[model samples]
Target: MPKMKTKSSAKKRFKVSATGKVIGSQAGKQHGMIKRSNKFLRNARGTTALSAPDAKIIKGFMPYDR
Candidate 1:
């Protein structure tokens, strides 16, 4: 059988932790930061785990992970 490839876009944007959680960057951090409040900027600085439904979908794209 042929190897299933990981989705290139998913690989770049998401991370799977050792415990099987999906970790990703917060939104609104990509551009136009000047208009955002300090709190928004502070809150957008870390990775967050995906919800169960979201994780399930992402799992398909990340073939090597659960």
Candidate 2:
């Protein structure tokens, strides 16, 4: 059988944590910073874990991540 390939886009955007959770970056921080409060920007820093239902779908795209 041929080897299953991981989705390049998913690989770049999502990460599999040590505990098997799918990690992803926060949204709404890419642009329009002028209107956003300073506290919102400060709190948005760093990645966050995806919900189980959502992560399960994303995980399908990462075939070789295991």
Candidate 3:
């Protein structure tokens, strides 16, 4: 059988947590850093678990991750 390809974008952007949840980095940190407040930058610094509905879809793209 042909290999099932994972979504390249999802592979790069999301992580599968120990609890089997999908996590992703907060957006808005990619640009305009100077205008962003310290609190906003700090809060956006880490990965966050995606909501259940979103995580379900992401898991479909990352078949091997599970």
Q: lDDT of all predictions, in order shown?
A: 0.91, 0.91, 0.93
- Per-residue lDDT tens digits for candidate 3, residues 1-66, read 888999999999998988898999998988899999999999898888899999999999999899
**Model 1: per-residue Cα lDDT over 1-66, one tens digit each:** 999999999999999999999998888888999999999999888889989999889999999876
Best by TM-score: 2
Residue 28's lDDT within candidate 3 is 94
The candidate that achieves the highest lDDT relative to the unseen native structure? 3
Task: State the lDDT of candidate 2 residue by residue for 1-66, as single tens digits.
Answer: 998888889999999998999999988898999999999999889999999999999889998665
- In model 2, the worst 10-residue window by lDDT is 57-66
Per-candidate TM-scores read 0.85, 0.88, 0.81
Looking at model 1, report the run of 10 residues with the lowest lDDT sum. Answer: 22-31
Model 2 clashing residue pairs (backbone): none
Looking at model 3, report the run of 10 residues with the lowest lDDT sum.
42-51
TM-score of 2: 0.88
- In candidate 1, clashing pairs total 0
